[model samples]
Each structure stands twice: as structure tokens, then as C-alpha cells.
Target: MQTVKYFTQDELASLFKAIKKKKSKYWLRDYCIFRVAYRCALRASEVGLLTVAEYNAQRSELYCNRLKNSQNNTIRLDDETKKALEKYIRDYGIDDCLFPSQVSKPISRQTLDLLMRKYCKVAKISDKKKWHFHSLKHSVAVHLADSGLDVKELQHYLGHKNVNSTLVYFQFTTRQQDNMYKKLEQRNYLV
Candidate 1:
């Protein structure tokens, strides 16, 4: 099976920059969506259906009612994500949905996908073959794993029902694999 794809920090920054230049009315909302998804490792449906009531600023946790399964997850937000969400909430007013649609309801999964595609095009991001809305979630998992977060903890953080799902990110990247081999060679473990 092909490895899952993820966006690096540079690529995420590029996409954010492209989105900022649009001056669209929904820019703030979109920014919030992207930031929350990246930081929280949420699926598109979770991101789309996020509500203001689910965010507990004092706790810095956003509750995600998992769409794929009934088990819910409470995702911790980083300072950056908290700041962005605060700004968006202030500007948009916290009423029902965090990211309401034209009808003032939660955005649908299809609309979220379309918005992601539009931003990807605007950013001129190549390698569309591997990148998609779900890449943001993969990026979060990969980044956390690279930072030495225990695999079990990452599985819980990503709200994966099965540990096998989380194991994919633990499968080291090329650079990490090379480093591991070098260490083993230096330790004379390799014959």
C-alpha cells in the first residue's frame, strides 16, 4: 500500500499565505477551519460540524463528535490555534456553528472539500496526487510522531479506534530510516 501523504510546515504556510491574499469574506472562517483541523488532527466532517459550544477556552480543548464512529474525542489546542479561534469567534460571533455556511448552518463535507481544493490551487501546491483535505490530519500525526510523541498517545490524540491506524505514521520517513540504520551500524549491531 502507498504511504499516506502530509504537508510540511512550509507547505502549510504557503497555503495560508495564499488564502490570506484572497480577501474573501469567509477568509477568517476558512483560516480557523484550517488551523483547527491541522492542530486538532480532525477529519473534514468533524471540522465542518464544529460548534462554538464544543470549545472550552479555559481548558483549551475542542470536543470532536467523531463522524466515522460514535466515540467522541476531546482535542487539545495549541496557543496558536487558540489565538486564531479566538479571533474568528470575536469577528464572527459565537452562536451555533463555528463555521457556518451561507444558510448560517454548519458547512457540509462537500463544501469543505471544495474550499480546500480552491486554496490548494491558489497556493500553487504541486503533488496533488497525494495531497487532499485529509492530508492536514496526516500531517498532524506525522509531525507528532516525528517529535517523539509515543505511538499510543498519538493514537488517542488522533482518536483512532485502532492502533494499527496510528502505526502508519510511526513507519519512519526516508530520513528517519537512514538515521536509524546509521546508528545501528555505528553500534556494530549490523553485520
Candidate 2:
């Protein structure tokens, strides 16, 4: 099986920090886009297809429209992500599209990919080719799996149509295995 490329939590923090340092006019928008993408495990196209109507500010819920025949789901937003979405919506005066381009349409997937590349470069992440926008999805998946989320739950969270697709993330890395072993030892499971 091919290895999945993803950012470590530290790398994600670095990426966000680098994005904030730019202080560009669209910095908030860019940051929110990446944050939402990672938090929701959304594909670039799914991010582009997001609509304001799909977000419920009062409930802090987001309706994710999955692609590639994946199951669509409505997920509750985390406090931080909820705040960011509220601020982005209020500040941008968004009426329809969640992340609109200058043309008032949803931003294109290519633009998202380009923005990811730009931020990855600013973050000084090596192997730029491996850290495309989709890496956000993989990063979140791995992070969630590492956090002890059940595989079935993760499958639903990722909107995977097949468990096999979700099972790929269950292949833990060496560091993850070490962490698990340490946890087991701490709990005296090895005794």
C-alpha cells in the first residue's frame, strides 16, 4: 500500500502561523478555509462547493456535502472553528457561497490548491509536492485515528462509502505504535 502524506500537529501549527504572518488582505479567509478543510476533513472540491446555507450559526453545525459518492453528513463545529466561521461570514458579508472569490462565486479548487502550496512554502515544509490541499484531509484523519477514535466512527466522520477506504488510516505509523505501546505499559497491560 502507498503511504499517505500528512502534516503533523506541529506542522499544522506552523502552517497556520505562517499564514498569519503574511497579514494579506485575504489572510483570514485563507486561514478559515484551511481550518475548515482540516476540521471537516473536506476535499478541495467539497470546500469549494460549500454554501452559506449549509452552515447553521445558531446550532454551530455544518452540513458537509461529500464528493466521490461519499455520504453527506452534518457535523457540529468545534468552538474555535465555529468562531472563525462566524467571524468570516460577518466580516465578508457572505450571502451565498461560504468562501467566495472576487467574482462572488465559490473559490475554485485550483485556487485552493495554489493557496495551499503557497502556505506550505511559507511554513517551510519540505517535500512541497507531498503537501497538497488534500493533505489536510489525510492529516486530520490520521490525527483523529491517533486520538483513539473508533475506525467505524472515523469512517462515518470522513463520509467514506466503504470501510476499506477508512481502514487505510488504521495502519498506524511507528511513532503512533510507540505511543500506543507506552500507553499500554503505563496501564500495566504488558504485565
Q: What is the C-alpha lDDT of each candidate?
A: 0.83, 0.89
Clashing pairs for model 1 are: none
Q: What is candidate 2's lDDT per residue for 39-125, written digit by digit as tens?
A: 999999999889999998899888999999999998888898888788888998887889988787789889998999899889999
Which predicted model would earn the best lDDT? Answer: 2
| Candidate 2 runs further than 4 Å off | 173-191
> How much does candidate 1 score in TM-score?
0.88
Evaluated at residue 5, the lDDT of candidate 1 is: 83
Regions more than 4 Å wrong, model 1 = 172-187
Give the least accurate 10-residue stretch of model 1, judged by summed lDDT.
170-179
Task: Judge candidate 1 at residue 61 and give its lDDT.
Answer: 92
TM-score of each: 0.88, 0.90
Model 2, TM vs. native: 0.90
